[model samples]
Target chain A: MSLESDIPSWVQALAGGGLIGLSAALLMGLEGRILGISGFVRSVLEADPKLKGPSTAFLLGLVLVGILAQFYFVDTLTNTQPRSYMITILAGLLVGYGTAMGNGCTSGHGVCGLSRFSYRSLIATLSFMAAGMLTVTLHRVLMGGM
Target chain B: MKQQITHFIIGILFGIGLLLSGMTQPGKVIGFLDIFGNWVPDLAFVMIGAILINSIAHKFLMRRGRPLFGTGFNLPSKKDLDRPLIQGSILFGIGWGLAGFCPGPAIVSIGGLQTPAILFGIGLVIGASVFIVKKNQVK
Candidate 1:
């Protein structure tokens, strides 16, 4: 079933995706950094004072936009029904551990890694995408609806 | 000083991109991943758009052999295909499929101070922290 909305989903994705790409480019051009949110989030939580400054600033920037969007793009940022806390937290744990262990997430492996044409990234991307698809399939089967 | 400032500004831009792309919506994310179900292909366009621009930028920037602002490009160097890479990613996917929130969206959602996002964030911190501690113990 296709979703019905005022703006087409693909258009939203492509335009927003371009901005994400630009953001990565700017980071590389100006700061010589890969804009991997998982890495930054890990660094912020790691207590390394040296890394704290840049990582914190980057994360804060994301949060700042979040705050601004709450006011400006309220409809765009729609709220979803909360899952059980146990399930939500469990999902968080899996994400945290998985990204940490894998050393990258969607942005790291999917965007930057593939852009660099690393075979390693290709494998990683395929693996995670497959896993996500499988998990969703299982969820739908066992849990009924999401 | 300049480095930190740059990260902050770019981070804001990245966040905005995420919101504009409709990636901030969990339902959309789940829809995209739900190949067996509705199978929304919006996320594929997002990836295609991002990769197309970044690939062009990468070709030029890498040829420069150094970043405009910093000493060198801080790209990942590991070439080996290892177990952790595959296993960790699979695990992350399961979590992502479960909640439809990845690290970026989860963090962005926190700006709104939503309960689910906050809870996920806390769990993310704990999960990552556990890995760090376990690695430290092994070391």
Candidate 2:
């Protein structure tokens, strides 16, 4: 299928977008920290002395909520496709290490930081997008489109 | 306690939001990244919508001296840019493009029992640990 044909309807996008924004806002207003997924992962994985409790709770919430949501949105949402296990591992390494050192990810840098007009976020967003675009192109050329 | 409960509620809301928005789907993410090809711009709207709301809300939220649950709003105050930031972002971007699974969506995928998600999540955990180990060694 052509890429254009793959996008979801605008209504779903807007509603989902609004919910994402609201969720980030609620976290900020309530917890006073950026909802960057990488940061959360780092905190939990590293056993960050300061972030242990909140991070655990947040991660738990993310997964628990996801399980419940899948049942509700089964008709609209599809499960993640399996790729070559090697590809998944390598890519996961890149994403995880990058975000761990960089201090954010799509949620943190793309949404939260960009909204704050942080210069770092701007650079990060561009970098990730460009990298993502280039990687996709390379994958298309090399892996024959996974 | 109360804070943990709130976090749990937010997590559920965030997951539902991601699923409803199709952020949990790899094809959609690939479509968004495939800007040069048969581009799909719908996910852009999700990003824009979230940013717009957050941008507006942050301004107002900043006025409050203390957070609802804590003593203060612990915003990232650093203004300096560094190598780690750029390098990290590039790697993240490449991985994101390759896998279409950032930590958030990857975790969701894992929650849903996707095999790729499981592999990627393991990578994420190990990769992060490796970075920590390497960094500690350097220090």
- Highest TM-score: give the candidate number: 1
DockQ of each: 0.75, 0.66
Q: Which stretches in model 2 have alpha-carbon errors above 4 Å?
A: A1-8, A75-82, A143-146
Across B63-135, the per-residue lDDT of candidate 1 in tens digits comes to: 8899877789887789999999999999999999888889998888899776788888998999999998999
RMSD of each: 2.7, 3.3
Give the Cα-based TM-score of candidate 1 against the true structure.
Answer: 0.95
Q: Which pairs, if any, clash in model 1?
A: none
lDDT of 2: 0.80
Residues A50-142 of candidate 2 have per-residue lDDT tens digits of 786777787787787556555654443363444688988999988878888888899999989998899999898999999999887777768
What range of 10 consecutive residues in model 1 chain A has the weakest lDDT sum?
A: A1-10
Clashes per candidate (backbone, < 3 Å): 0, 0
Ten residues in a row with the worst lDDT in model 1 chain B? B22-31
Instruction: Give DockQ: model 1.
Output: 0.75
Total clashes for model 1: 0
